[model samples]
Every structure is written in C-alpha cells, then in structure tokens.
Target: MSRLATSVTAALVVAIVTSWTTVVGDARADTARTQPCTRYTAILAPGTWETHIDADPAVPVGMLRPLGDGLQWQFGRDITVLYAPYAASAFDQGLTYAESLSTLEATLHHMVATLCGSTRVVLAGYSQGADGIGDLATEIGNGAGPISADRVVGVGLLADPHRDPDTTLSLGNPQPGDGIAGARSQDFGALTERVRTLCADGDLYCSLNATASPFLSALGKVLSGDPAPIAYLIPAYTDPGTLIEQAVTVGAGWAATAANLPTILEGLDTLPRLLTSGDIAAAHQIASGLNAALSPMVQAAASVDLTLVASVIRAAAAVDPSGWTSAASVIADALAYVDIQRIAFTAGHIQETLWRTMESLTRNDHLQAAAELAVLTPSVFDLADATLGPLLTAVRGDLALAVDTLLDIGGPESIDELVQLARQGAALASFYGSNAHIDYAEDVQTLLGFLRTQVAS
Candidate 1:
C-alpha cells in the first residue's frame, strides 16, 4: 500500500519540525518518573505521516505523558521513547537519500555525543524513522554509542512498513497480514530484544489490499506512518543566518521519486468492485494474470514533514491541561497489545540471544560497523559469536523480498478486486505451499482500519 502523505505539499513541510525531552533527575528520583534517566525523545515526521513520538512537547511520549493516565506501563516502568524523522532521499528539490540520511546521522550523533550516550535509551520510530532506528540500532548494537543494547533496557517500535506484501484477492478480508504483512510483532522483537533487558514487541500496520483473497500476506506490515526529527520543528538558519533552503528540498525529491503514491492508492480502490462481479473465473483470470505479492509498499514513513505535525501541536499545545485526550486510550490499548505479543515472539528465545550478542557487542566493530564505530563504543565487539547475529544477517533478504510483494499487489486498482485474489492466494498456497506473501491476508484488513485513523483523522 502507498502509506504516505498522498497530498503533502512542500510548503507545509517547512512549518513543522521541533525538540528534545531530557530528564535530569537520577534514575531513583521517582520510580514513578519516566524522566529520571536524562532522556531525549526527538521526533522526525514526514510531510504527510502520523503525529507519533512526542504528540505535544510538554507531554511525554508513549509512557512518559505527564498525566498519570497517558503513561504506558511495562513491567510497571515507563519507557522513554524518541521519534526521529527521515526525509525522503529522492526529493525533487535537490535532496537525495544520502544527503537526507546524512542530516539525520549528524543530529543523532550530536544527541548521542551531548546526552543520550551517557545512559540507557529507548529509540523508537515508525516508517522511515523505523528504518533509521534499525540502522541506528544496528550501529549501536554492533559497535559503540552512548548506550548499548544491553544497557538500553528496551526498544519499542511501531510498524516499520518497509517491505512489500502479496495483493492477490485471495488474501483480502483480514484473514491474515492486514497491514505490513511480513512484519510480525515477533520480527521487530528480534531486532530490539538485544537492546532492552525486557522482551520487545512492536505495533504492526498491515492492511488488506486488492487482489481479493482471504489469506493474508506473510509480509504485510508496510503502512506504518512517519514522525520527523525534533530539529525541524523550530526552523533553522544557514551560515549567513537565513532559513535552510533544503528543508523543502526533500519534499521535491519525494514528488519525483515516489510520485507513484497517488497512482497506487487510486489503482487499489477498484478491487472491491472487481470481487463483487459475478464471474469467478473472470475474476480468477484477473487474479491469475497478476503477481501482487511481488510489488510491496514503498517510501519513507519519514515522508511527512515533522514541521507540519509540530504546527498542529503548537496550535493546540496550550488548549488544555492534557495534550491529546484520545492519546490515553490509544496508548493504553496499544501497549497492552505490544507487551502481550513481545512474550509470544520471544517465548524465552530472546533472553538467550541477548547473552550471545553481548559477548561480541563490544568486539566486532571494525567488520560490522561504519568506519567511525570503534571511536563511538567502548571497544570490544564481535557479532560472529552472537547467536542472533545469524538471524539478523538473514533479515535483509527476507524483508527485501517482502517489500517487492507488497508494492506489486497493493494499489487503488488492486484493492477494488480482492475476494477473487484472496481465493487465488488459497489456490497458490494449496498448490505452491504458502510462500511469504500467503500469510498476510487476514492482517491486511486490520491495517486498513488502523491506517485510516492515523491519516484520515
């Protein structure tokens, strides 16, 4: 599915970037306080993504919300979460992936150098931010950073929505892989378990795409939205003390590179109509002719400009004593979902892997990390010895394949005709024996509902 801001304009992007939340008290200042760890939760938003991370500056993100109510409890402790935006690398306005990411790296590097490095951190993100966090986590987990995974104590992630899923009609109707199919709560667990002492879990955003099948994509969690880096909220100045020009440059890049987002959405809208037609074989003809799972979703959830979300928050920040009234309800339920799934994915497997990763955590820096890594960590690493390293090495291929499947199948046209496509998935699974995309059908339905809320809201 095209999980991005379909209509986000460049101008809006320049208006929303913003800050950090650091708690100065000791860890024991208040067992009830989520801020005692000297925290920095920075959000990076997309020009058209959801408003995650710090919904409102004064309010703590996730579990740290000021009101006792907005707090998310896990093992009875509040987790300090940060969201960093990832600008699209292909913005038409003179931006590229290398440059956008470089901007993020510099900011994160600063955060680590100035504050985050001293204590444990719970780096969190969605969409592009998710990708960045994973990349960042790997660097930190593999080498040196302010806080190591072992020291981090926890990592919470939402739908990373980076892969593709099958879009055959057979996988329609929430049978499986509702949103971002291949991305299981368990998958993210493996990625983050090494960081926190506790079990890790993530929110999945899988949705039903056209192609009309009842089975779900094995890889569907692709629509997770974006959050921007905190830096963009307050507008910055160039060397001459003027506004930075590339702020909107990234948006232009997206218009050029991922411009297909609107087309994808429009194409999928036809699936329901196609499935409703009376001819099953004709529908099958349509289904059999296409390979939806091969396409997958695209774009950086970091597509939305954080500046826009910040503008919304700035307007509403002082409206009431509580930030977002509904945040309490949303966070509580979501946390419950994440915590339960974390246990299921780990099933005690994570604890063992954690021990293995640590042995090499401080060692294999030169091989696994960027050239500058050894200088960042305490210097003693070796991933080869870590049991979970093998799984991580394998993750890239699995996820890459998953991405292709989602983009190929989900689109406005594909969505209009899912039932027959879902039936096709059943046929494929029965004959081909359940490929990666087959499992996401059911979950896609769930994702549709969730995604609609995040943006249409």
Candidate 2:
C-alpha cells in the first residue's frame, strides 16, 4: 500500500481503538478509584496528538491506554494509574513539543506533591510523551526532580526520543542507534536501575542512526528544547572566537546566495527557451549571466557547513527568554521539516550543471548546452519553491531516503545512486510514522509485566 494509504488506515485504526479504550479506561478508572489509596501510583503520559490539554484523566488514550488499563487490572487497589493531561500537540497544533513538555512536567510535579508519603511512583510514556518523561526521570534520578530516587519504583519509556541504549536498559528487538532527539547527556543516575526503554527495530524516533544524520539528530535536540547535543555534535568549535567567525562565514554565504537567487532563477527560466529556439548567442548570454549570478551562491553553498549552523541554533536555544531565542526556536523547528540534504544535493547539481553548460557554450556545443540547461531549469525552480513547512508536506518521502542514503553510503557517488538510496531510505524512515510506534502496547507487555513485578516487590 502507498505510505499515505497506510498512514490513513493507521489513523483510522487508532481512532477506533482510542474511542473504545476511552470507554474501557473510564470503567477501569471508576473501579480503581473506589478502592483505598494504593501503595504505588503509575503516572502515564500519552504521545503527541494523543490527548488534549484538558483531557479527562479517567480516560487514558493512545498507545499507553493499554498499559494503563493493564496496570489497573493487575493491581486494582494496589496501584493508581493516572493518565497525565497535557497539550499533547505537535508544533503546529497550538502548543509546541516544548510547551507540552512543560505541561507534562507540571502534571508530574503536582502528582508527586499530592501523593501519600508512603506511596511509590512508576512513570510510563510513549513517543514525544516519552521524551518528557525521560527528561523528568533523569532529573529525579540526579536528585533534582519532584520525587526522590527511592520513591520511584519503575519507569517505562516506549519509543523515547531521548533514548540512549548506552545508559538505559533496552527491551525487545535491538535497534540501530539512540533516539532521534539524541540520548540524554546525564544518565538516569540513581534511578538508572529502575528505568527501562523499549524501541521497536524500525522506529526512528527512538532509534535514529546518529552518525548518518547528525544534522537531523541535532535538529531533534533543538526541537526538544535541549542544547546539550550541540556541544557533543560540534565539539571542535568550542572557542568563542572561532565559533563566531564560522557563523559569520556561513551567514555571509547564505546572504550572497539569497541575493543572487532571483537573477539565477530568471536566467534559468529564460535560458531554456533561448536554447530551444537555436538562439545560440542568446543562450550563451543567458548561461554566462546564470554562471555569474550562481558563482557566488555556489561558492557560498559549498562552504556552508550545516553542522555549524545547528550549533549556532543550539546556542540560541540556550539563551534566556527573548525575541531572538523564540525566533531561533521557530527557525530550528521549521528546519526540522526541511529536506536539507536534498537542498544540498540540488545546490551541488546546479553548480555542476552550470559548469557543464558554460563549457558546452565555449565549445560551440549549443545542443549539449541546451540539454544541460534544461536539467538545470527544473532544479532551479524546485530550489526556488522549497519553503518552510511540515516535513510531510514539504519533502514527503524524499527526506527519509536522502537521510538514509547519507547514512548508508556516507555520501552518494552520483545523483542516480542518491535517488536509488532515497527509495530505500523512505521505507526505513516511514517506520517512524507507522503503526510500529503505536502498537508498542502489545510489544511491551513483557516490560509492563516487569514493572508490575518491580512495584510489587
């Protein structure tokens, strides 16, 4: 089935399942509430787009609903399963992932404050929800959270964006790498023993190959409102003066590219007709104009290091609340959806195409020059049209494949090879948005059972 069909079908299934789960969960909550205070309270946070800010606490939904229901069923009066109500939204849905994270933190804090002193806590979250819970778990484990380390019995994270296989105990099939948002810098500290993470083999959210797409991983960190990844991702530019100089260089490059974009695009548009009409003189003139306009941009683009740009973004994210910080965050978030590798590839192709066209013109090879410039025209249009939007809307399948190719081959030898790799990578990246991430409730039954045992013991 097409990816879109699969996604639509999955959405339908989730909607149906969530609706039924709500009814079942409400019933379970009602029964559990009648019992006396339990020895342990299990706090659950659902994934992005799973629950609303004012969602009913008694009705757990999304991927964690089954886990919540199972805990209530197994323990009855021994455990209280509370589904945290937060703005479970993506960046476009009013509240950003960072805002939702704050909401989740506040909910956990309130739960910890009101719980009985003797009651222990178990935390569980899925996807973006897992991202927040993992961060909190790190804080508590490091002796800075709402509850003490000993007060927490078990922590379960499904498809956690901050998953670090090196630090946390992983269950189920082995994954390729740590979470796409990159791993938490600080280990779980005192709570490390109690925390367990589960990521399905193909789920990129929790198992993205950091080496292949360091920029994507870095972007993930920025989106999650974490700046620590920048330090690790770009360790070489620690000196302030050097970092500033690099940033200035990148800025100047982009500025020049932006300045010449209009002229380059115009030339690309007009050169084709000129070539097709046997206007050799006109075509050569246009090609020369394009080369001149594109030269500075191509040079700038070649020297543009995306890694450094990400670091600058990280520095911006770390700043105190201000217009600049907010703007940086917005820009970073928008960039998360952009197919940067594809853009880089296009930029490279434009330079190569322009070079060939110029060479053909010099040799009086009008036909060859026309053919080459034809290829250049579409690419220029595509680059010109590339805009900031959701990844799905902007690059769709290409983004994943481009990332995957970069991961597999280190770099493509030719555009054809890159295209082939992109096809394979799309399938790999599609797993992130697939049912694999959402169906973890069944996949993680073993972990849930372990949590029950841990709390009981």
> What lDDT does each candidate get?
0.30, 0.62
Error of 2 at 393 (Å): 29
Question: How displaced is residue 50 in candidate 2, in Å?
Answer: 1.5
**Model 1 lowest lDDT segment of ten:** 238-247
All models, RMSD in angstroms: 28.2, 14.0
Query: Residue 357 of model 2: what lDDT?
Result: 76
- In order of listing, the candidates' clash counts read 157, 0
Best by lDDT: 2
TM-score for each of the candidates? 0.29, 0.56
TM-score of 2: 0.56
User: Model 1, which residues run further than 4 Å from truth?
Assistant: 1-106, 144-147, 162-457
Note the residue pairs that clash in candidate 2: none
